[model samples]
Target: MFFEEHTGLHIDDQRYRGSGTSKANRMRGFWTVEPDHVVARVLLAMIAHATEYECVPADMDDALFADVHRIIARLNQNPSSPVPEVDAFTASVNELDFEAAAKHIRTAIEQNEPATAWIACTCFR
Candidate 1:
């Protein structure tokens, strides 16, 4: 267990050993809570965790970037579906606006097609 070994300390190795930059990025979006304004602290318990499979392998590229955008779109959707971060994310959604990050998310999906779903999932998170 890399996590156990690195408890309170940064091991920065394995699977992502030499790819902290990408790994740092791909690690986000573990949450799946639906959208809502005035985010509720009560939603903190819903945080989701990405699986090792969902970690987005160190080998990512343009196409993979595109897929990440798609995930952002879905996350931006405020869909009826509920995920862990939905509420925590909603609180920040308003702040995250203006940048139109959601638009970027869509563009990444439409323009690039190779981006993996996991990358997209991490994009917004």
Candidate 2:
């Protein structure tokens, strides 16, 4: 509903199913086709719609901002194994590379999390 209402992109069930072959995968395939910013914006909108608390990423504090990105990264990750993004995230933590870890989190959120969240929105609607 949000995708069509806001972004004008219809979610065909078959096509969407292709995005995540199984329920456990959390829909990583959306990034392979859609633009990152678009997916992020749609996810943000859906969050605002459901929570009634809109977030402006620029207005978030540094820690809060990074935390949100990390949350998103975690949600998008496969439960069965570590993906490259998760590996990089773990390496950054092991090396105490705060900036690199933050970058990895942000990139993972931008590329994967939002799209997966958008798909999850279907359950509610």
Candidate 3:
């Protein structure tokens, strides 16, 4: 996986600490513009925000996953809700950058969606 291949980046530890041993347990992300930081907002969709997995509670996974999928689809098809920092980074990427794709994601996070942010940062770590 992307994370295992890049273990040298030290992103795994930053993303997960005292968390448990499940997909959700390792959702807390350590995002930044740097290679390892990974732009948290883009990560929010993966693992369905980790909220479903993180809590290990009951039935919450269903809802979280639904929301995550919705967010993912919206980003894939929509063009208006760009992430906050996308314009600045676009010049550097080939133009189809996932990093630039993170703008809408950042907006989603602004709604106090910590679970999404956590999942995003850790998903590709």
Candidate 4:
């Protein structure tokens, strides 16, 4: 919901391209961020560097870091589904081993782990 509100693009609407449905007809389709979108790729790279160095980039301010931490906190609330990589990433962040955290984040993304990737993306975006 936050993403939809911020991006003005619904995830569900991504499926309606060329469907000719009324809702799809009324609005543009394929507007949602794709996993391989340029913005996502650029952010991921920045996150990797920042995490590796354990220092926020000059362009990324304190407020962005706070938002990232908030997102991570929300994700941590749901521990029923155990993801070892996510757990390790969180630990890396806590220990200030940003490079290790970046590694874990990359793995999470490669594994199609949206929650983990979302945390990193939101932080940098």
Best by TM-score: 2
Segments of candidate 1 deviating more than 4 angstroms: 1-60, 81-125
Q: Give the TM-score of candidate 2.
A: 0.36
Candidate that scores best on lDDT? 2
Q: How close is candidate 4 to the true structure, as a TM-score?
A: 0.27
User: TM-scores of all models?
Assistant: 0.22, 0.36, 0.25, 0.27
Error of 4 at 47 (Å): 34
lDDT of 2 by residue, 9-95 (tens): 655445556546663232344545455455565566666775575545555677975786675555445444323333332332245
Candidate 3 TM-score over all chains jointly: 0.25
Sort order, lDDT high to low: 2, 4, 3, 1
Worst 10 residues of 2 by lDDT: 84-93
Over the stretch 5-77, how does candidate 4's per-residue lDDT look in tens digits? 4444453553644555565342333323232232243334446667888786577788887786565445434
lDDT scores of the candidates, listed in order: 0.37, 0.51, 0.45, 0.50
Clashes of each: 17, 0, 6, 2
For model 1, what is the C-alpha lDDT against the true structure?
Answer: 0.37
Off by over 4 Å in 4: 1-28, 31-33, 36-98, 120-125
| C-alpha root-mean-square deviation, each candidate | 15.6, 15.2, 11.4, 15.4
Backbone clash pairs for candidate 2 read: none
lDDT of 1 by residue, 1-125 (tens): 33333222232333333434454432322121212311211122111123334655457686966775565555445534333332233424466562454445444444433233225546656
